[model samples]
Target: MAREKRTEQLFVTVPSFFRCPISMDVMKSPVSLCTGVTYDRSSIEKWLALGHNTCPATMQTLPSTNTTPNLTLRRLIHLWISQADITPAISKQEAADVINGEFDSNSLTKMIGFINSSEENLKFVALSNHAVPKLVEAFAKSDSMRVLELIVEVLDLISMENAVREKLNELILKSDGITDYLSSFNLVLQKGNTESKVKSARILELMAVNSDSQRKIAEKAGLLHELYSLCSVETETSAVEAGLSALLAISTSRSVKKELIRFGMVKTVGKILSGYDYSSAVRAVIEKSLKMLEMVATCTEGRGAISEDRECVVEIVKRLMKCSRAATEHGITVLWSVCCLARDGTAQENVAKVNGFTRVLLVMQSDCSSNTRLMCGELVKVLREKNMKSNLAPYETKTTHITPY
Candidate 1:
């Protein structure tokens, strides 16, 4: 009875082709060699690295040792694994043990597999078992890059739970564990690949729930800079948004806002806005950028940076009434800061140059909030006055209720 149960659990009926010829295990990363024979990438690579020029299974003389990924076979194996009613190879207790115990790559891989198999169940198990804190502990102590990446991937998965998220924030904000976790995250941000960076940024954003944590997170070396670097339009939209959301979380701090300005966030945001076309996907990024600009504009340096960037100011004006209501409000707030609050004459003139007068009026005619309408009034008055001085054609301001602050 015990032997039958073990055989049933072992996927004894797995296809011969699915197993690597050398390792006799199901191929995790199947690759085909020059001899048209497939083997697990790691197993074959290890064979070739030993100075053997022939295929391991067929002993065929290799023209070249280059291996191509057998994507079809890999997909089939994945589908079979998913459909098979096989029990989890790693139990919840085993996962907890691996995470809490000393670092083990093979065990970690099984833990990752178990978690990936059923994330919802594992989330509860992780929370109950205090898996997040253990993972953080592992994340800090691990020196291997692959191990660190695996740890981050698991953390990202479990972090979807609110309790798990709050626990992570506590770890970041707690004095005892702050250095280890923060430095580890900064290392990942600096050294990890794009996916890892995105995950780390998102994790940081989750931790930055309020001002205290945000300020603390911003204080970490090169963390803000790494986040800022991920905001390019050329990168994946998810990465760009992850970077922006992380910065936005921390931007409430005046000091952090200054750091962002020093890192050239204003110009980068403007360049992104200038280059991106309006798509459903890009609209969210635009809104977030405008909102961050508005927050930064609250500071004198931020307002100055926005005003000095001619294209940025123009893009700010162009965004009015073009995106969502929230985006329009943010754009107006940014313009109001530079033009009215800061009394930037150049920004006022740029507004007039972009036909911003018409856009602001369009905003006013829409169902904007009462405060936004008032800002529109002030913007119109400023632009009109600036245009009059510059001998530019004046817009007819009488069509809407105009009250200048």
Candidate 2:
């Protein structure tokens, strides 16, 4: 009986290294920082997301926040779990009970683990078992940031299903639902760390499916400003993309577009376009930035901003036919809005100075869309008309026949 008791104690007590210092839970995905301290990926990510620059375990100042996966440690944890006969799966009823009952960190962690597990059967079971509504109830009632983060993470996972996503949208947009969560979301955006902010922004983007929701989301106090701040070149690429994507979802409203300009969005996008190295930067970010620039340029204020900033205009000209086809189209649209539609002479001159005539001709010759070809034709006409007296030889007009489309 004494021997049996010792075995029981051994099974109950987890090794210190096997647990994350922040959460004290067995590390699901272990990673190490520059200080050589290992932690669970989720916990350490949350710690860094909160803007802490030091190692959590040693409290030592960190040289870098990058985490390397501790593969050997992860393997050991898996082996220990197997040897100890530990099963992480919870029954469907148990999942509903835990979610409906008081917030328990351990139980929530298990649910997250179960949902994120490799077993396809378990994932289907969790979702089929009324997990979405129960979790949404917890999401609405819980005021704890930690609880919100965990719940949001789970919701984000569950949101992959079309049915679950539609249900979540309904719950989020119901009367007073948007109002109640907007405050909480605002708090998260203001004080919660990077990871939390990204998740909240994603949820906001998903919820803004229609004009009413889009307008409401944009009108949220300080929401646009916070999202605008995330578009900085200094921010992580993922965060920047998330911010741009969310803004794009709501930018259909003319008022929202104007508000974004008032927030200095044009200048921010110009800085990102001019400062970021295209080769190293993510393609999606470039496309999104250019797309956002084009959207703002449709309005009077946006066109003025783009045309006034000579560097921004030049940068837009430089990206012609250089990035993806979508980016090229966006770039062309911005130039068209400022030079052709708005008829900004400075923008016209900027295009000519950058040898844009030749670039436009090259795009015209390529298999571009009909609308893009028309824009190029107009751009060529404007550039030629503006620089009629100057030596047109530099623009290679004599060598390449300007196709009159």
Candidate 3:
């Protein structure tokens, strides 16, 4: 039968074709794609999804049904790869140092294309986690933003075990060059346009889950103008959300918060709250902004902590006044936090900055969100030290969302 002959040929020519073009490793645990190509176990899964029915090299159409092996290819791959020298010349401890010492932007860019077009190269990187040293070294010193991006993509996609989270944390802490990597990376954001913001957003999200990511970025020895810019982006909800969360983490460093407010975090958040392309996403952003601002307002004195011009307060008040029902809920929380911040030393000066009490009363008089009303009344109760006062009448209505064009 033709199928029998094809099977024989597959076994015969496999010595030459056993390597995945994408990963460049002997195709172990070979899984046949519907496209009629057999690939490394990890990668064939991807090929099958794209509806490819032929080998890229042989152009043979793969059968759509009934190709199951009595033995799954994982065993085969395990056998083949087990024979491979996956064992590092150096211990895992040296992974950071073993990375390409001269990895620059151009090299990283080339690697990106290679990783995209060839799985073999990706396999090499994945198998040799030790080589991360080379990548980090290159990204750390390079000025090209794209390299930083490519390197991050590779690290994130590589399979890391949840059990090893603690070990990885320790390893990263021992590793050098992360700060340099982020510093050079942040510079790229400053020079980049809209696309740059997108890249930074993704990087932040990926790093957000990393245990030491915030500390590493804060120590990166770069100005945060780029992060601030991403936070301000109005068109992209993903970028906005990532940027805000990134700021929240970075603000843990008192010095970092100073720089962020200086770069205009409050105003950018205000713009996001004022109106944007998506209400659902915008409201979500407002919630994050409220939470982040609460954390920030906690650590610093009113005058010493805020930007010198009181821009943050004025901007927040404006945002609260203009926010819709969803955003107003968060807006009130922020306002309440600010009210407390106003209470300590310079209570008069702080209150004077935004006419804190009046702003609270305005929300009480006109604001509709029940959550907002309760919070305003609470602030009055706290600040006025009131005892059963009738002047604190509350308004009850629903807030509206920003209308789309």
Query: How many clashing residue pairs appear in each of the predictions shown?
Result: 0, 0, 17
Candidate 3 C-alpha lDDT tens digits along 14-74: 3434555434334545665454445555555565557765443333444552234324455
Q: What are the per-residue Cα lDDT tens digits for candidate 1 across 114-210?
A: 7655534556546765577777788888887667766776776566567888887776587588887888888887787766677788778888888
Who wins the TM-score comparison?
A: 1
Scored by lDDT, model 2 comes in at 0.74
Off by over 4 Å in 1: 1-89, 93-97, 232-234, 394-405
Full candidate order by lDDT, most accurate first: 1, 2, 3
TM-score of each: 0.74, 0.73, 0.51
- Cα RMSD, each candidate: 15.8, 11.4, 15.1
Clashing pairs in 2: none
| Top lDDT hit | 1
